[model samples]
Target chain A: MAEKVIAGRTIQVNDEGYMTNPSEWTREIAAEMAKEEGITLTDKHYAVLEYIREKALAGETLTIRKIGSSGIVDLKEFYQLFPGGPLKLASKLAGIPKPTSCV
Target chain B: MATKEEYPLKKVLIICAKGNLEDVYAALVMANGAVMEGIETKLFFTFFGLDAITKKRMNCLHTATVGNPALRMPGGLPFPTLLGILPGVEAGVSAMMRKEMDKLDIPPVKEFLEMITAGGGEIYACKLAADMFKLKKEDFTEEVLDIITVGQFYEMAGGIGTQIIFV
Candidate 1:
């Protein structure tokens, strides 16, 4: 048994830590997830989220540590902005054809 | 079994020092390759490289002449330096290069920068070069993220897997 819902979606996390349906994920999905997590999704949040997703889709596989090193924004602020946090947000929004472990 | 690391060259920093045809072409090739490989690419233009981004000089970049072996004339004819001085020679070469790039689906320098930035890559202008060249912020393409020092560029390039390349 694995966690089905992190923020809002009924996502299935495998034992290997991959999202079952990563292709269906999008920035809007992440935004909605953030909302369900009790966080407001602002344009700036979307910008950062989208940027991260683009990089991930490009196959960057950004970790929280790597995200922190980017210097695009503060890590603490990033945490507060995204509901599922960097790793989840990056995985959900990365636009990868399939979901793999982002942890 | 060992799993190979995927998405090599995740972070690329392209230092553009010349805006001529070969230089700009080199930068574009590298940047495009990085983008295709899903890497985060950044292009920092300095000195002559700034010309590639400037509105006035971008379309007017010249071809390199000195020390280029392919520039020799045929039939044992000595290549005339005056031909380079002729009007539209540089423009013609630039046009041809642009056509070839377009055929290859490589975006223009400005649009390429936009695509890179839009795709999660950062673009920066060299502050020292900008100041030395007396270039205002408005003089550069709007895709420029900021005017940063070389140290700042290093800071961006500093990471476990980041790569810094000069093209």
Candidate 2:
């Protein structure tokens, strides 16, 4: 486990850089992480992030194409927003565990 | 700000070295999964993997049943190696595999590639393989990004947070 200081708030993160405790996540933390990923947080990105958090809170397992089919964003836009790895990166930014099916 | 190299596990590069139905699908599933995970994903096709993107063979790909230890009949019966060598057996097995994939609503090879590329995945073919097979650039589907040498391939794979997977 590793600790990250975002907005003067300390949060626990896994070795993969995912927040280990969802309760410690905040909009400030998300913004900080997004900046680190070279993205400027926009409403579109927030919509996807919040969608992930909502589904994670409800105990759902999400895959890349699942989000593509969600109609929040098309597959192409999803990739554009989260270029490297959409589901894993989004979940990490959203303070959720990496989706098990991603690997 | 952290440099790109400092980032751990940034992108995924999947190498599809086999052209068989199962092998190509395995690579596709993983690459597509990576993209959905918001990971940057690139797939490199080498040797027989070229069949996956070849316009003529992509749709006609077949499952390899011969000497495949993990293959089983529809009823969970073990697939006998001897039975796999018989005429039409491989095609039957391939048809069965396609049917199962259809039941799961999996897309066909071409469509799957389209979906992956549209989702921001990159696709490339091996230059050596293409030359050996006498394939020209126009011989492949529109989704292929380029035909590159091994050296170029490694260079592309070299990046922070990038993981190279062989399937």
Predicted model with the maximum TM-score: 2
Docking class of 2: acceptable
lDDT for model 1 comes to 0.65
The deviation in Å at residue A76 for candidate 2 is 3.2
TM-scores for every candidate against the unseen true structure: 0.56, 0.68
For model 1, the docking class works out as incorrect
lDDT of 1 by residue, A41-69 (tens): 77777666666766776766454434544
DockQ per candidate, 2 decimals: 0.04, 0.33
lDDT over C-alpha atoms for residue B25 of model 1 = 67
Worst 10 residues of 1 chain B by lDDT: B65-74
- Cα lDDT computed for each candidate against the true fold: 0.65, 0.85
| TM-score of chain A considered alone, across all candidate predictions | 0.55, 0.93
lDDT of 1 by residue, B27-109 (tens): 86677456534567888899899998887777666675444446545355654666756687656656766786666455567
Worst 10 residues of 2 chain B by lDDT: B2-11
**Steric clash count of candidate 2:** 16
